[model samples]
Target: MEAFTRLDAKIAPLPLANIDTDQIIPKQFLKGVDRKGLARGLFYDFRFDEQGREVPDFVLNRPEYKGAGVLVAGDNFGCGSSREHAPWALMDFGIRCVISTSFADIFYNNCFQNGLLPVVLKAEEIQQLMDEARGGNHVASIDLAAQTVTSPSGAVFHFDIDPTRKDKMLRGLDAIGETLQAKNDIDLYEMKRALSQPWLEEA
Candidate 1:
C-alpha cells in the first residue's frame, strides 16, 4: 500500500446515504480478485446506464469532478456487507481520502489497510465540506500528519485515528510490511523456539 501523508485535491460530493459495497463496485465486476481494472467498475451501476452509457448526473461522471482525490459523502457511507473490494475500487479511482460523518466498521478498517483515509467528522462538518465540494473546483486539503481536513471554504476540522493504523499508513506498511518491521525480533524468537522445542520439528 502507498503511504498517504497528505492530499490537496478537488472533492467529489456524494450526498447519498447508505451506499453499500455493491453500489460501489457491483457484483458483476467482482470476478477478478486483482485490484487493477477495478476503476472502470467503481460505482458501475451508479455511473452507467443499462446500455452501458455513462450517466451524466452522477457526481463522479461530471466533468468538473474528474480526477477528484477527495470524497465528501453522506452519513453511514460504505454500509452493508463487508467487502475489501470497495476500498480497492475507490483507491484505484484515485480517491485517497473520504470524509463522512460515519462509516461501516468493516469498511472503515478496510480503508486503512488499503491506504485510503476514511475520515470521520461531525455531521455539520461533513455538510460544510459537502457544500464546498458542490461548488465547482473547490479543493479539500487533508494532512494525515496533523489529522486535519481543511475545506475550500476555509473551515478546518480535526479527526482521530488509531495510533497504530496511523503509524502504519505513514510508513506505507501493509500486513507484510508491518511484520517486516519486527524482523529482528521474529528471527530471534524463531531461533530460540527451534532450540527449545526440537522434538516439535519435522524430521
Candidate 2:
C-alpha cells in the first residue's frame, strides 16, 4: 500500500446515495485476485453504455473530472457486500480519498486497510463539497496528517479518524506491513520456542 499523507487534486462528484460494491466494480470483473487491471472495471456500469461506449454524462468520463483523486459522494457510500476489490478499483482509478456523509462499516474499514481515506462529514458539509466539486475548479485538498479537507471555495472541514489507522496510513502500513514491524520480536520468539521444543520443530 502507498502512503497517503496529502492530496490536492480534482474531485469527482458522485451525488448518488447507497453506492454498493457491485456498482463500484461489478462481479464479472472480479475474475482475478491481483489489484492490477481493476481500474478498467471501476464503475463499469455507470461509466459505460450497453454497447460498452463511455457514458458522456458520467462525472468520471467528463473531461474536467479526468484524473480526479478525490471523490465527493452521497450518503451510504460503499454499501452492500464487503468486497475489498472496491477500494482497489478506486485507488487503481486514482481516487485517494472518498468523502461522503456516511459509509458502510465494512467498506470504511477496507478503505483504511488499502490506504484509501474514507472521510465522513455532516450532510450539509458533504452537500457543500459536492457542489464545489461540480463547480468550475472541481478540486479539493486533503491532508491526512491534519485530518482536514479543504474544498475549492476554501472552506476547511475537519474529520475524525482512528489514531491507529491514521498512523498506519501515514506510514503506508497494511496488515502485513504492520505485523512485520515486530519482525525482530517475532523471530526471537520463534527461536526461543524452537530451542525449548526441538521435537516440535522437527515435526
RMSD of each: 1.6, 0.8
Best by TM-score: 2
**Candidate 1 to truth, TM:** 0.93
1-203 in candidate 2: lDDT tens per residue?
Answer: 89999999998889999999999999998989999899999999999999999999999999999999999998899999999999999999999999999999999999999989999999999989988887797878999999999999999999999999999999999999999999999999999999998998986
lDDT of each: 0.91, 0.94
Q: Name the lDDT value of residue 147 in candidate 1.
A: 96
Each candidate structure's TM-score, on Cα atoms with residue i matched to residue i, is 0.93, 0.98
Can you list the residue pairs that collide in candidate 2? Answer: none
Q: Pairing residues by index, what is the TM-score of model 2? A: 0.98
Residues 1-203, candidate 1: write the lDDT tens digits: 79989999999889888999999888888898899989999999889999999999999999989999998888899998898999999999999999888999999999998899999999999888888788754788999999999998878999999999998999899898888989999999989989999887756
